[model samples]
Target: MSDQEASQTSGVIKKFLYVNRRAPHGSNYAQEGLEVALIGAAFEQDVAMAYIDDGVFQLKTDQDTSEIGTKNFSPTYRALGDYDVKKIYVERESLEKRGLTQDDLMPLVYEDEDDDWEEKPMINLVTAAELQDIIEQSDVVLNF
Candidate 1:
């Protein structure tokens, strides 16, 4: 069935969690996961994304794929807010282990429509335990 049909029939907004554990460029997992999340959001699902392990690097800024002969898809992340997929959780442990900080990541933000469209940060630095809780709360979990 189509997304609109499914939504009209069920009228249920499910919480979808897309978990990323792979590096962004080496394979297709990260990119595919991102595409799926955007599609889910477009379907009016409550979409959230989690970055863990090497996946945290996906959010890092200033990615240059020119030398590698790969298209730089990192900029697409900034568009998540437009899709209403604003809950982007970055695992603290993952960043620490890689000697990275939140500052190293892209500055993603969203406008709060209910609050006079106030711009707010979208990337949330979360503990492993907190991320687990979020995972538990999700209705569907997609792993990459």
Candidate 2:
């Protein structure tokens, strides 16, 4: 059997890439995407999440949804690390067009056992081309 086929039969982890392309709270897509990511992570798969276009706004800090009659779920992103879902990639171009920087995003960090349990940033800044490469390497890609 081929390497990938053999790996699948051996129950090796599969790489799952979730692409988020919508503005958070404008509709249900962003929230649904996050839900899907959480579900996939729960399966113990290798999950990688990419935020592109308006989806980059989902990580913006200090989001207040109370005025819109919605519960602010932005903080949930911070909890993703607890679920072991930490490979978050934000497209640099998308952030630039939105006039956002890494500082504008919520500080998502995880406890690193390899680093003596020190916390490290979960979000990764990536170029559009790099995101594309990631998509290509994934076993499955879910676009939102």
| Model 1 lDDT, residue 102, Cα | 95
Per-model C-alpha lDDT, please? Answer: 0.91, 0.87
Looking at model 2, residue 118 earns an lDDT score of 91
After superposing candidate 1 on the true structure, give the runs of residues whose Cα lies further than 4 Å from its correct spot.
1-10
Q: Please provide the root mean square deviation of candidate 1 (C-alpha atoms, Å).
A: 1.5
Give me the candidate number with maximum TM-score.
Answer: 1
What digit string (tens of lDDT, one per residue) describes model 2 on residues 34-88?
Answer: 8888755546778888999999999999998888997688888988888788799
TM-score of 2: 0.89
Candidate 1: tens digits of C-alpha lDDT, residues 1-144: 376665674667889999999999989898888888776665778888999999999999999999999888999999999889878999999999999999999999988898998889999999999999999999999899
Model 1's TM-score against the true structure: 0.94
Candidate 2, residue 138: Cα displacement in angstroms equals: 0.6
Residue pairs in steric clash, candidate 2? none
Considering only N, C-alpha and C atoms within 3 Å, which residue pairs clash in candidate 1?
Answer: none
